[model samples]
Target: MEFSPRTAIVTGSDSGIGRATAVALAEAGMDVGITWHSDRAGAEHTAEQVRAAGRKAAIRQLDTTVIPGCAAVIDELAEELGGLDVFVNNAGAGDGVGFLELDHTIWARTMDINLNGAFACIQAAARRMVAAGNGGRIIAVTSVHETQPKVHAAAYVSAKHGLGGLIKTIALELAPHGITANSVAPGAISTPMSGQDGDDPEPTLYPGIPLGRSGRATEIAAVIAFLALPASSYVTGASWAADGGMLQMGPVGSAHLDSSNWRQG
Candidate 1:
């Protein structure tokens, strides 16, 4: 089916990758619904950019950790936007607690925010798309850890892995509905989450990454924008890694590890 997306909802659009994606979709001629977890001002800023691109923009405060109730925001936004053609689950959280130090609270919070919340929101969006009888796109912004394990991030890795698997299953179940589900697993990015404060990633040396630097949020946004387009109709259930070859560095990284400090993390 051909996709002519006119409206999109991106959770966590207050800043970083989500903000970039909202703007990209707007630039592609779609009205955007932007949500923020804690930064209403930031979300408004993103909305301003969308409006500047000559598209309608809607703003809402969304806390994914709120579960089934939080999913209502999707419906509200879809209604406000006239309809929903694209849904991007970019709201997630992570911590540096190792497996041994990981507690139930932290674990559950991480799961609630990253995996459980994603399930609810994506399901809500899919239901709307199915009811509208319009094919749609569902994209999740997972991490490279979705496919690889990382030190000091057991919960994060687990959540991302679960979210990735959920997308694959959704792809199978929703294929007949003309909805495509996919995940974008990004590597180290220069966002506030990475302590970079949205700086240019070019000069920042990401020693182990093959690209020699961290990825820019806009770079990941481009990949997501492509997946949202009709050009990606043939693509689904795929996890596109926008990482600068970070996943490919496993063997190569091991070969270059000159000290035991790598395990200390």
Candidate 2:
């Protein structure tokens, strides 16, 4: 437990990375609010895990795209937890469509959830924190695509890219208020959504990946927990990469050379 008596709202926290983040915060001794759009059972399960960590938990329905009274939702959660301290903007979705095949609707929907939703959620959380006159942490979960361009994911890539910029801006704006904002961009993580058999997410993510493996949700969560820690009070407006040396290398080249094929193992 790193931050006790603190309240954190992790949106879309029913499963996968979001669920893991919520649990991580709970284990850090913070009371957590679990928001789910469609996974009530999963949300309750997460709450149970939080409670098991000896902290209070709250579950709420937060469709960030709607942006209807989202701050009110956070206010309620903060009241329940006794105060607001940290907020994780982990809710998002992607279209998985390439630039050419991507429809306007797909782009709009992707932006609405991935980019716009995060913006709204951050604003709502910040408003409550400022109102309560308490400094807090706001961590956004971006993707490797935030900087790397991925094929067949134009909308997703663009939205993720914008998310990083948004976090930077928020960090600058909120610094005067003693609130910190940062982003965590994770590489291919072994999640059910990535369909990696709960083992290796990307044995072949790309030859450029020096680590030669996809990351895990827990791995990413650990970095997030670092930013959320009170010790990181001096850190803000930074984008931390958890891509396993992917960024240290060159681009993901598609051209495989035949001369590279060796007969010997």
Candidate 3:
């Protein structure tokens, strides 16, 4: 677990789970590279937190949907931080369009960010690690939807399922190079993406979350940090769900009721 002076990159780190992960990595004694798609201020704030933790912080602008160029940001940050030791593919977009209403444009956008972007970035990082002759960690921030499906999020579900498969493949390919690949699948986390401005969850969101509340971004980050550790070398090709027992509920929960209400709003 001695990550002292190691370098890590976290995408979509301007806020939410990404921000928490960047800071957590810093606190664990690793220099962190933080990227934001649109929120420069939030990225800066995350940098400040990293600096305060006595670790170096590098910030960059990355739009995962930008194709091959988007993945180059990892190289840039690695150069700035001296080298790459960990890469967290946390940048993703969610879709809520029903299956019948989904369009090619929406599906493409979702796949471009959540799947294509991650593939490119992982390739870039793994190349560096392999060339450097040092093992590295590759963690993707998938969701419970990676396994369980939602009523109206066809695109997102498909992209995450693909991501899960990609991570497993990477785990097999990279293990020979001494690198490890895994995923952290979160449930309802109280981030801006989940419609909460703060760490606390709304009462209405409690019904589906088995812990009776939404999770905090830091909760998910802690798991990511564990997977990043050198001691986790044997844990590749696994999806660690940080969900509040929601995934375990499965068909037994109230969510299984024969109701089309989930598709209405």
The TM-score that candidate 2 achieves is 0.88
Off by over 4 Å in 2: 1-5, 196-208, 251-265
Error of 3 at 53 (Å): 0.3
| lDDT tens digits, residue span 20-101, model 2 | 8888998988899888888798889889888989988998887766766667677777778777789998888877776877
What TM-score goes with each of the models?
A: 0.97, 0.88, 0.94
The lDDT leader among the candidates is 1
Error of 3 at 42 (Å): 0.7
What is the clash count for each candidate, in the order shown? 0, 1, 0
How would you encode candidate 3's per-residue C-alpha lDDT over 1-265 as one tens digit per residue?
2332388999999888999999899988899999999989989999999999999999999887888797688899999999999999999989888899999999999999899988998899999988987788999999999999998899999999999999999999988888899999999888888776743344345766678877889989999999998768679999999989989887777656678675563
Error of 3 at 179 (Å): 0.5
- Cα RMSD for predicted model 2: 4.7
TM-score comparison, 1 vs 3, better candidate: 1
Model 1: per-residue Cα lDDT over 45-141, one tens digit each:
8999999999999988888778967778999999999999999999998988989999999999999999999999999999999998889999999
- Lowest-lDDT window of 10 residues in candidate 3? 196-205
- What C-alpha lDDT do the candidate models reach, one value each? 0.91, 0.81, 0.88
Model 3 misses residue 58 by how many Å?
Answer: 0.7
